[model samples]
Target: MAVARRRHREPHFVDVALRHRFLRHAHRDVQRRRIPLPIRHPGGPQVKLLYDWLTKEQGKDVVVTREPGGAPIAERIRHILLDPQNKGMDPKTEALLYAAGRAQHVSDTVRPALERDAVVICDRYIDSSLAYQGLARGLGEDDVLHLNEWATDELLPDLVILLHLEAERGLERLEGDPDRMESEDVSFHRKVGEAYVHLAREYPSRFAVVDASGTKEQVHTQVRAAVLPFLAPDRVET
Candidate 1:
């Protein structure tokens, strides 16, 4: 019988939890889905509260960090890469810069945490590159992927929750002027969307796509559902 099914991936600067936070109540585990809007919307306070509640319920089992900015050196690099004034930056140069920042971040932050057996969850990771530079910039997914592999010693995410949103809709959710990537042409954004969709299918094992258009609670419900099973905590009732 024929049926329907779906999947997903990530974007943005990297920031996850400690590597062992989920089971040991200390570390991080990456989530596939993201709902930034709910965290900013007028009613988004509920989502933030839910997150605080859940994290508290889980105890001090996670460490939230972002790459390219988590470490001081890398943060400087992040500024250079994302500054709208740097739009003239070559695509390959941009990709390489991200990888460089990641390399420093991993060497200084990620690897050390994992060595301590901590679950490290990062906000954006390799998948972001595959979507932005790989697909959107026409830089070949395999190429961007290979670049990151070297950057992180092939450290793959345990999970990648994609907050699936159309480019236009995603843009509308923003309050400030668009950043370098966000400021790209509509067609460019459309390509980014396509790239994400493609990535979901290409990497289903760790990727789970969730709708970003739902209400804060609705969206949080899905993200919580996806992450709870992994944490196997005394599940927060909310």
Candidate 2:
């Protein structure tokens, strides 16, 4: 079981790799699980707080990881995808690259962690591609989804915690310069926001949307509420 520490007043974001696979059933016979924390609007990586909180609260072996770069090979691919110099990269190529990286990430990182009964907290997953390259880049969502589904062998998130904020507001909140994905125009980001809403509606069973316009503490509170039920007594690792 994990140990608990005193709560801090001010929380800092840790840009670490995170992917979630929570155990929901008390019966040890049940299979392990995975959850994705996909921030609709890219800004500060806020999910780390939840990862940290859950680590102390859940008392389970936790694995923190991210997509497009969890494994060594995937990290190299992430560099190519995020390099500003890679501007004008074809939309299809970009989507394929993301899927390629995800394929490696799942095989080498996510799957192995899940198999070990650890809770994997992934920072992003397939929904990112469905929104970015699929909707924002003018590629069809179904096509992109299909590609990733094939790439990842249809492993889906048991729960999707989406942090919602206006595209413009999110961009304004960004500190320092933008990465390749963040450098996209406002219009592109708006489309990404819309894409997320569409996905939430499309997969209502697994999606939980939390407004992120509030302070980090407020946002973290909401995220905790959304995740608490999943950590029911039956789900806690013994």
Candidate 3:
């Protein structure tokens, strides 16, 4: 007799959202001292108290191991790219750090969430590295793709949500907190945009482009529409 195969059913939107909320809480609890994670919606007073307890009730001495979150990875990559010492570092080394950080992040954060049936919303992933580092080091597209595949160990996102903002608009959004990478020359951002467009063209099924030039509500609407199929049965088109 043939062995029976178990089919894995996809999680509903609300379930995924709740799981994401828990993961966000865990992530924020880990980094309470550094930067506070933004809450997507206002919760009851109990939730607030819970958040505070997670931060304070747990003794500061109780070390939560540092996981490779997307924000930290981006910050680290920006530092490495801008470091004068890195000017002498070969392209392979540069690529290695990115791959290492990504692997650690996926292993620590993303993989766990996926296992628990949560939808992972990342700030940036392989595509960003492919565009930024690949262009910066003059690595060809093939090499970039190969490096990303090796680095991520071929773990791919179910959907890649690209916030398509005009270069000027994206720069404007970064005006308040001008990090080294955020403050890069407009020309570079333009190239990044171009690369993103190329990537989308090359992988249309995986990529969903959202007009991020609009207000938060507008952008959210667009993103919601794009995500509706996976989110709700009613939203799915026959």
Give the alpha-carbon lDDT of every model: 0.62, 0.71, 0.49
RMSD of 1: 8.8
Worst 10 residues of 3 by lDDT: 32-41
Regions more than 4 Å wrong, model 3 = 1-68, 71-92, 175-177, 232-238
Q: Model 1, range 1-238, lDDT digits (tens) per residue?
A: 0001112323422222212421111123333221111111112333344346445765523334564466888999999987999989999999999999988887787667655544455667778888889999999998998899778765656556677777788778876877787778889988988887898787665566778788777877776666555443344344
Ranking 2 against 3 by TM-score, winner = 2
Error in Å for residue 77 of model 2: 0.6
For model 1, what is the error of residue 212's alpha carbon versus the real structure, in angstroms, after optimal superposition? 0.8
Ranking by TM-score: 2, 1, 3
Model 2 TM-score? 0.82
lDDT by residue for model 3 (54-110), tens: 335421111111212354664576477556544466766766677777776666666
Leading candidate by lDDT: 2
Quick one: best TM-score, which candidate? 2
Give the Å shift of residue 219 in candidate 2.
Answer: 0.8
Better of 1 and 2 by lDDT: 2
Give lDDT for model 2: 0.71
